[model samples]
Target: MRPKIYLFGDSITEESFGDGGWGSSLAHHFARTVDVVLRGYSGYNTRWAVKVAERVFGAAEGGGGGVNNEEPLVVTVFFGANDACLPNRCSAFQHVPLDEYKRNLRSIVSFLKKRWPTTRILLITPPPIDEDGRLRHPYIENPSNEPERTNEAAGAYAKACVKLAGECGIPVIDLWTKMQQFPDWKNACLRDGLHLTRSGNEIVFEEVVKKLAEEGFSPETLPVDLPLITEIDPRDPLKSFQQ
Candidate 1:
């Protein structure tokens, strides 16, 4: 079986398989070498992720929680955008307190480590939010005209995520900080001020691949699953296909 990478998170991750999406880019980059799996849930937060852990990762039976018996090459934990929603805003239903958010993130990392001891776990911080963009592309009705989320709130969540990753000794993609490095990140990197745009997807794809490469999963490092035509002697092609 091919090695696999799993993605877990909220809307941003759920839509990662779309056209020009980072997930799709990864799939293409690793085609014929590894399988990329998606396990994203729209509108979810760390708190809810912990709640559904048993379901996503089957009950702790026979040692490995049952997403699969094979240990994945990497697994990404990305949740926070929604967790940063203001408690009194339209997205209040999904609001989770800052303290609880930190606890939930730790719970998730612990859960993954238990499930795949040898797998590389990567954490991704939530990207910065554009208040005007959110208002323009509202996910929910905002009659009060107040943004359900704010850049400040999202920054707090991102900081917590980065700190958690450091404490846990895992690599992290600090999208919040990285995106802001671009002058027009609000429009260039994010489509709805929260989700990624094509350029944003490009950034994610590059970062993920770069990180995975450092962890020894580069294209040159991975063995190809099947022989390319050039690898076969035209006169004895069958020999190259021997399993």
Candidate 2:
């Protein structure tokens, strides 16, 4: 039987299976060794992800009593994105506050460990934002719809998460740094400079695969050609030009 991997994350993971997020791409990458079960939601924070553990993995929710005896081999927990973002939809500039963000991430990891005692956890950081402080838009023509949120601050948040994950003895994927090295990362996001493009999703998928391999996860066969959302043309108005 293929090992089951329970994925807990935010929008980037959420978009994978639906319209082309890294989560969906991951399904293909792990097809040879593990079955992917995505439990990601848009706009959900680490705090909220902990809630899913109670809601879906709890006995009252029709899950295994307190332990996940069913699938115990693998599980990935990713949530800092929304947690580091503004609390409500009302303000785009507001954030969850750095200190609180750390606490929430700790809670999320602890909760998963308590439930899935033997599961392997992989914590992923959100991607980097464009350095110019300007975001690209797909449908909208102006930046009025989206407010400036600090990508620089995200590095600190990611490090905090990495530190916490270390306490839990889990591996982490530094997506922020990887995206920064990409020549087109700045111009690869959708209308907003936050989300990733199909190519971006591919980059994420590759990184995860490489990390999993480094962590000693060797699958007999890996799936490579999973369809993704439509690709955006660089010259298109919806696409941003970094150079």
Residue range 1-243, candidate 1, lDDT tens digits: 889999888988899999999999999999989999998999999999999976776666644344755778999888999999999989999999998999999999898899779999999999999999999999778888999999999999999999999999999999899899998899999888789999998988898998898889977888888897789989988998885
Off by over 4 Å in 2: 60-68, 86-94, 131-148, 189-191, 221-243
Model 2 scores what on Cα lDDT?
0.66
True lDDT of residue 64, candidate 2: 50
For all candidates in order, the CA lDDT equals 0.90, 0.66
Residue 214 of model 1, lDDT score: 82
| Cα deviation of 243, candidate 2, in Å | 60
Error of 1 at 218 (Å): 1.1
Model 1, 80: alpha-carbon shift in Å? 0.3
Query: Candidate 2 lDDT, tens digit per residue, 109-216?
Result: 776677667777788887776535333332224335443445766777788878877887788888878777867667765325677778778777787778778777
Model 1, 221: alpha-carbon shift in Å?
1.0
